[model samples]
Target: MIKYHVRKDQAITEVKVSGHANYAKHGEDIVCAAVSTATILTYNALERMGFKDNLNVSVSDGFFHLEVLKPNEFLGYLLDNLEDTLHQLELQYPKYIKYQKEG
Candidate 1:
């Protein structure tokens, strides 16, 4: 299972997505959604790039989770998109900084 916690202006959102393989013989299947509007923008950009080929997107103002059958390239695509989306979002809300702290 993957979980994401998104906060803005005192509003907090939590999102979780997970998947389990039927058996080791079968491949792992999974998809994750974020609890941020930035995530929706990322999804749209991905779709514009001809991705989201089999992905499903769902949302609500407070929280939302999308489910999709994991695809061969989805994970890499998701990572790249998230980075890009947050970069753009930061530009608009520069006061809110986001960075991964190295441990």
Candidate 2:
């Protein structure tokens, strides 16, 4: 299963995604693919918007972590989009994906 954890602190947000959905074979897992794409795109988008200095991102097999050191409205919007997407996926694949929020 994939476990997604989100944390909020003042004007910062941190997201940690780990594990595999295992809904299908490696290359055939749509859930995993979607999550991976969303994370990568979010990180890239933030960097492109001049948030590179305020962001920290790490990606590895079955793991991804992103920290927004100084989040703004746009950053929050992006994170909200990501959370919503993951929640939607979780609804469809309850046994393979889960989400949690913390402060």
Candidate 3:
């Protein structure tokens, strides 16, 4: 599994991607789906923290993008949300991947 943490301003989002990088089309497709789901989870968390609606989310060409209406005000909140999310994900999917961040 390859994992990374993306921080925009102060908002930190952890992305852990696992699966066969070199495999059949179907396997790659599944990995894409997993990545997309993780992205949605991040986006929704930001929304819950009062991020304004700016652009509709779209996952295509193996990329995910989200427009944050206010980066300054929402940064800390977003990172906090990400931390909580990672914790939950660890609990829910213990066998998938673990979030390794030093607090």
Candidate 4:
């Protein structure tokens, strides 16, 4: 299954995502592909918008993590968009993905 957790604290908002949906074979797993595409694009968009310093991100085999070093009014919108997208996916594919948000 694919899993993601969002944690928020006084100074930072952290997002951790890992695992494959395993809903299909590697190249054909649309769930995995959708997650990857959304994640990478969010990272790139933040960098393009000149907020790289305001955030930290890590990616590795089957995992992607993001930390908002500090919150910004605009950045929150983007982050929320990402979360909302994933939440929709989780709703539709409950057996393949899980999402949790906590303080």
TM-score of each: 0.38, 0.90, 0.39, 0.91
Question: CA lDDT of 43 in candidate 1?
Answer: 61
> Which candidate number has the best lDDT?
2
Relative to the true structure, how large is the alpha-carbon lDDT of every model?
0.42, 0.86, 0.48, 0.86
| Candidate with the greatest TM-score versus the true structure | 4
Residue 42 displacement in candidate 1 (angstroms) = 1.2
For residue 5, give model 1's deviation from the true position in Å.
Answer: 7.0
Which lDDT tens digits does candidate 1 get at residues 1-103?
A: 2223232222212222223212223233212222154566666765776756555566654344544444435544564556555555445444433333223
Candidates by lDDT, descending order = 2, 4, 3, 1
Candidate 4 to truth, TM: 0.91
The candidate 3 region of ten consecutive residues with least summed lDDT is 15-24
Q: Candidate 1 regions off by >4 Å?
A: 1-37, 80-103
1-103: candidate 3 lDDT, tens digit per residue: 3232443444533333334222236545443345446666766776676563543444444445454444454555554665565456556554543544434
Clashing pairs in 2: none
Instruction: List clash counts for every candidate, in order.
Output: 0, 0, 0, 0
